[model samples]
Target: MAEPQAEVDPKTTEEMEVPSSDPPENDNDQDAETPKKEKDAKSFDLGDLVWAKMSSFPAWPGRIVKPWKNVKKPAGKKAVRFVFFFGTEDHAWVKEESLKHYEENKATLSKAGKGAKFTKAIDAIEEAIVKNQASKSDMESNEQSVGTPAEGQTTSPYHPPSDDDDDDDDIFLKSISKPTKDYSREPMAGKKKLNSSQSASSPGSSPRKGSNSSSPFTKINTPLASPKKRGRPFKTLEDGEVAKKPTPKKRPSTGASTAAPGKKARSDMSFLSLNLYNSFQAHLAQKGETAKKDIKPTEKKIGFIGLGLMGTGMAMNLIKAGHDVTVWNRTSEKCEEFVKAGASQAETVSDLVSSCDITFSMVSDSEAVRAIVFGENGVLDGISDGKAFVDMSTVDIGTVTGVAEAVQARDGRFLEAPVCGSVQPAMEGSLIIIAAGDKELFDECESCFQSMGKKAFYLTDTGNAARMKLVINMIIGSVMCSFAEGMALADKSGLSQSVLLDILNLGSIANPLISGKGKAILANKYPPAFPLKYQQKDLKLALAMSEQVDQPLPVSSAVNEQYKRAKNMGLGDKDTSAIYKSLTH
Candidate 1:
């Protein structure tokens, strides 16, 4: 299929040699690479903001430029548009259906995008587009000055449809002797030009100060790019660079690589080797892409709900690890801290859920979790296919299962990942994550889990992780209560509470909870880490679960009463270690 000519402004410096959009053909040529969608089909013209995707490649940002006509195509194939890729300075012919509207794919593209490559691609493409528009305005002014074209030539034959298109990475290369633009940071001007007589290793190897020289691997006889093979590759030259001519060699009897009598054969001499295209692929991949951003695709577009002490620390860890974190809180002011720390603020749970790939919520009790996930403008309101919702709140198994079922019913995924360890561990990125439900979603969250926690266990069932979380918190409450009792008893006996803490923390039974909370008790500073009420709530939930399972917990039963006494004493809002105050009061 031959491509048609494109109209130009003749004012912009950057010339985009692209093809115009072809008319939709009545053929069954749509491959698995792109599915046919009559509803999405719309007309498009030159210079539109469209996304283009090719077979087996990630989507790339590009715009339609002027078309070079008469490019023949295979029979029974769909029409294609010439797409000039953003930063790579590459071009390709893309199918009409393969294009998506930029707005339609913006969030998905942003999630797919990262690194210097994606950023620079979009930035440079946008700059070019702005300049192109400015140049168009200039051309219109000139047209008025010079009198218009013949009356019939006023409207372009290829007028763009609606503001819509698609995206992909179907990049193809056309060989040229020189690059129109240099991709490197340094300007490709004013460098020493090498002569044919210069030897590769004749002079001394040490470089002079302040000299910028490329590595030998990057400096080859041909250009630092992959060009299509006709017979041999086309010669390309960088600024101040030379393409050396290879001396002809006689054919070998075994048909091995060709080499001049006294010269080493460059691996390139064997273009017909078994892995020729594979080698080109590897080289092109390195040449085209810059390094990745700290946040890879797996960890992009993370939504965090709740900004309480534990949520604050965990969400901060995600941000610090370079994930794109969007946070929402009941109190808008609480989100400001996260916003200042390079996180986006979502106004509602639905907004966060709809915009983000995976939303993780860590809030107060079951009521709070239920309220945020089920109320007006809540998580369910934004539930869509492929969205993931993970509740890290300390809710009971019944609550977890209910949320999970509701999410899955609405075509969204759900996971229960209740964490162990309090504010200190959360802030330090060492919380233990107990995860279950939707194994695939759990796997997708691996990078995020690693960022906010030291260890993560996949318990493989919806309520299993919540049960584990309850068990862990119940033990935490019981142990802390026991520790408080011991410290209070030691103080009364004059055995030195500090000494008791040191000995207990160093013994086989020593733990961070005992050591840290013991210090808090000694200082008589009852700031909340794991608040007494939440601990008591966890105990209360555990007892309820025990009742469901028909189990007896005499020690936990007694411990729950102690926490209740503390709660009634107005110590519920204080740290779990505040249980010591019940005995003293």
Candidate 2:
């Protein structure tokens, strides 16, 4: 509007530039800037060798296969990325900041020489990458051929290549190369080259010394030396002498086939002398006896009286121990069983005592014991010097003393051998024998004692064995009474009887007797191991003995009443554990 705007031409107004807010670009400035852009862009390139740190793996050498970018990020904001191949079919995406140019790290890389195995592994990885790229291109071009089957065929799932097919390729990448020895030989000034066969066979054919100029590609002849042992070499002596080996000692010779004197002979005996000795002895008996063996005394003849419950099993054990046994019982039928089992039967108790060297009597009571010893044709009628009598009956102490005195008057040895076990121990040969009387008689009858019992205790006086047997029986009766009461109390108290028995078995008072008898009581079936009547009789004798010695045994008296109560209930024929029924019923 000022001065009508000079009516400026449209093209001139457009060409007229306002004062520029930014500086203009020029050719010299672009020439100066070109190198800077090029330097930034050329920091890394495809196919460039680099040392890169990928994840937590060690800094390994890799080749940049391609440039990459994060498509999710804003343009030009993300870090420059590269796809690197790390020599095994393993490729990784790495950032440019984590990599260094291979040329700049040559000093560090040269320290680890590219060994033969490493070179082979790198070559293989490159071949694999090329093959993989080619296969991808081929698959794209033949896409229509894939997943389409011919007529009458079904489409199957595509199977990837098997790992086992490339196992050898994997093995090569994992292998480590051995170090090569440096054996460069200098080139001679006028020498001719040798062929491979001549160099292999010749010895001492090295190049001349002072030939400083050597060809880097020249292969020197090196003998393959034997490998050295791993540890430090055996040390040499300071005087340069070798060590001497130790001399071995010679062994002395033993005399051939001859045993020394006073030792058993080592004569080569026949099988008849070794394996068939017992059969040979029997054969000799079939013929006349050999004079080489002297006739020994026939084994001592043993006599047993009163084949009762305990007596029958005790006599059987004696016969089984190879004694010449003669047996007698009042019933006479009991003797028939023993007579059939290789035992001789005596017509009467007096015949048994007179015919045998030792007589053992296990009669019922003091009166029965007296009738066998002092009655008509009794043991006393057969007593004489060198003959022995062992009374194993549980009798009153007075009866035992009387029998001992009568036997001593007849000049015969007497032993009051009262046993502490009943039928089971008698059958098993494990009774506890308590013997008191002539010590020489006890020593003479030790084998007989062992055959009938497990152990024997020798008391010096005649009546002491009987007294000890009573004391033990007293304790047994008291314990049985207590056990019966305890079982009865347990039943009434709602506790398990078997569990209570188990607790008692594990307690300090546990023994074979309690465990065995406790089980019998729990089953309420009293198969007689020891007759209840016999236990009551033993208890009665124990109380009488205690009374004779002026010893008060309130416990023995109480247990005796319990046994009598059991006997009154007609349980005397049952086992001693039947006393439990007396308490509970």
* lDDT (10s digit) by residue, model 1, range 1-585: 001111111111112211124443222122222335742463544555567754433566776543322122223345555555554423445666677756567778745654444575677556555545555676687764323222112211221111111100100111111111100000111112211011111001111122353111010011111222211322321112211322111112111222235432122111111112222233334456221235443645889886654675577668766788888755333343355446766656787788889999887677767777777778999889999999887787878899999999999999998877665455445677889999988889988888776678999978999887788778877888887888888889979887887788679986556666676677565545466777888899999989998999999999999999989866665567789989875
Task: Name model 2 segments beyond 4 Å from true.
Answer: 1-298
Model 2: how large is the Cα RMSD against the reference? 48.0
Residue 184, candidate 2: C-alpha displacement in angstroms: 99
Question: lDDT: which candidate is best?
Answer: 1
RMSD of 1: 29.2
> What 10-residue stretch in candidate 1 is worst by lDDT?
181-190
Separately for all candidates shown, the number of backbone clashes (residues 3 or more apart, or on different chains) is 21, 0
**lDDT (Cα, 0-100) at 310 in candidate 1:** 60
Residue-wise C-alpha lDDT for candidate 2, range 75-143, written one tens digit per residue: 232243333333222233355676777657756743443433234334533543464455456657877
Q: Per-model C-alpha lDDT, please?
A: 0.55, 0.52
State how far residue 107 of model 1 sits from its true place (Å): 58
RMSD vs true structure, all candidates? 29.2, 48.0
Report the Cα lDDT for candidate 1: 0.55
